[model samples]
Target: MANAASGMAVHDDCKLKFLELKAKRNYRFILFKIEQQQIVIDKLGEPNESYDDFTSSFPADECRYAVFDFDFTTEENCQKSKIFFIAWSPDSSKVRMKMVYASSKDRFKRELDGISFELQATDPSEMSLDIVKGRVF
Candidate 1:
C-alpha cells in the first residue's frame, strides 16, 4: 500500500496538481483609488530606495510604520499624479493605511485629496482610498 501511494504521488499529473495548488496559495497586495463614484485599482511595484531611506529614520520598534509612494493619474483630467501611502500598526498585525495626494508643482505639500483604510490580514490583497477630503491646504 505504501509503494502504491508513493507511485501515485510521483506521477507528472500529481506534480502539476501540486504546483497549481501552490500558485493559488500565493497572495498579492492591491491598491485602490476612489474618486467621485468610481473606484480605480492601482498596481504597485517593488519598493524603491527612497522607501528604505524614509523608514531608516524611525526606530526599530517603529518598523511597523511604512510609507509607499507611487505614480498615479487623476480621473477628471487624466493628469499624472503622485501619491504617498502611510501605513502603521500598533501590534504589527493590524495596519491602518492613509493616503495623501501631492501637488505636481509642490510635491512636498500634501493636497486636499486623501484616503484611509484598515488592514488586518497577515498578507493583505488590497488597500483602498476615498478622495472626499478634497484639498486641505
Candidate 2:
C-alpha cells in the first residue's frame, strides 16, 4: 500500500514485521521513515534508567537519550542532537518510555509523531490494553 504522507510503497510483509516487533517489544527502537516506506527495527544498546545522568555528561543537544538519539543515528550523531523525551512510570514495576517526532527525512519533520509514544505511556487504567495486545495496524 502507498503511504499517504510520502506516497512510498510499503509492502504488507514489511508492515507485518513492524507490527510483530512492536507487539513483542523485541526491538529497542523502530524507525518508520515515510519517504523510504521502510520500517527499520533496531536492537540498540541495553535499556538503562540512568539515561539522564549519562546524557548530562555530554554537551547540550548532545545525546538526548544518553546513549541513543531521537533519529536513531550512530553514537557520534546522537551526541549532536537533543530532540527527544524519556519518561518513567511511577509504579513499583517501573516502565521506561521514549518519545520522538519522525517523518519522511525530506518532508515535514514531525509527521507520524506522538501517537504511539502517548499510547505506550498512557496509564493502564485509562485505555484498554487489548488494543495493544492485538494486531495494531
Candidate 3:
C-alpha cells in the first residue's frame, strides 16, 4: 500500500507478496514522476551496454509517480498503517502532485519523484550536471 504506482521497498516477506501479485497479473505500469530532485542509480549497467538494453532494464529518462505511507503505531498498530495509491505518470516532474499521501514515507508521497542517476565522471563537482528539478523529467 505504499508507492503503488512505482514500487515499494518492503521487507523480505512483503517483497514476496508483492512479487506474487506482480507475477499474477499485468496490472498497470502507470507512469510516475521523479520525487527526488536528484537520484543516482549508479549501476547504469555494463561497459558495452546497449541503449535498448538500458531502456529494457529501465530507461534513465523514465520514472514513476508515487506517494509515501507512514504510521505512528509501534507494532500492533502498524498493521493499520499503509500508504494507498493515488495515480501514476511517466512524467511526474511535468506537474505538481494534487494530493498528499500521508506522513513519513507518506510525507514524501507528494513531495517529489525518484530517479536513477550518476555523477558526471568528467566533472565530479556536479556543477555542470547535477540533474536539477527542471531539466531531466
Candidate 4:
C-alpha cells in the first residue's frame, strides 16, 4: 500500500519475500526498485550467493533498496548473521531518483520488521564488506 506522506507504496510481495529470507533462509538478498510509483521486488539472490554477488547486482548509475542476509563470524568464533537494509543511491544516479528513494526509505523499511542494520550508501565503497564488517563489530 502507498504511504500518503511519501507518495510511495511498498508492494505486499516485498514483505512476504523478506519474511522468507528472514525466517526460512530462502534467499540471500532481495533487490527492490521503484516502478509505477510502488516499491517492488526486482531480484532475489540464491542462498549460496556471495557478498560480491550481492554487490554486483546494482548498476553504477541507479538507486535501489536492498536487504541482504549477511552471515559472519565473530572474533570469538561464533557464527552470526544479520539482516541489512541498504539504501543505494549511487553518485551517478539522477537527483530526483535519489531524493525519492531517500524520502521513501523509512516508509518502505517499516514494512520489513526484522532488519538488523541500515546503511545508506552513495558510493559502492561505502557498503563494502570491510566497511560493513567494521560497522557490525
Top candidate by TM-score: 4
Question: On lDDT, who's better, 2 or 4?
Answer: 4
List residue ranges in candidate 4 displaced over 4 A: none
Off by over 4 Å in 1: 1-63, 90-137
Compared with the true structure, the alpha-carbon lDDT of candidate 3 equals 0.28
lDDT of 4 by residue, 10-75 (tens): 888999999999999999999999998999999999999999999999989999999999998898
* lDDT (Cα, 0-100) at 99 in candidate 2: 16
lDDT (Cα, 0-100) at 20 in candidate 2: 40
Model 4 CA lDDT for position 16: 96
RMSD of each: 20.0, 15.7, 15.5, 1.0
For model 1, what is the error of residue 119's alpha carbon versus the real structure, in angstroms, after optimal superposition? 8.3
TM-score-better candidate, 3 vs 4:
4
Instruction: List TM-scores for all candidates, in order.
Output: 0.23, 0.27, 0.20, 0.95
User: Ranking by lDDT, best first?
Assistant: 4, 2, 3, 1
Models sorted by TM-score, best on top: 4, 2, 1, 3
Candidate 3: tens digits of C-alpha lDDT, residues 48-118: 44333422443233333222121224444443222222222223223332232112234333333231222
Worst 10 residues of 3 by lDDT: 118-127
Candidate 3 regions exceeding 4 Å error are: 1-37, 59-137
User: What would the TM-score be for candidate 3 when compared with the true structure?
Assistant: 0.20
Tell me the tens digit of each residue's lDDT in model 1 across 43-125: 32234433334333333222122223333456655644233434322234312221221111122112212323222222222
- Give lDDT per model, in order: 0.27, 0.29, 0.28, 0.92
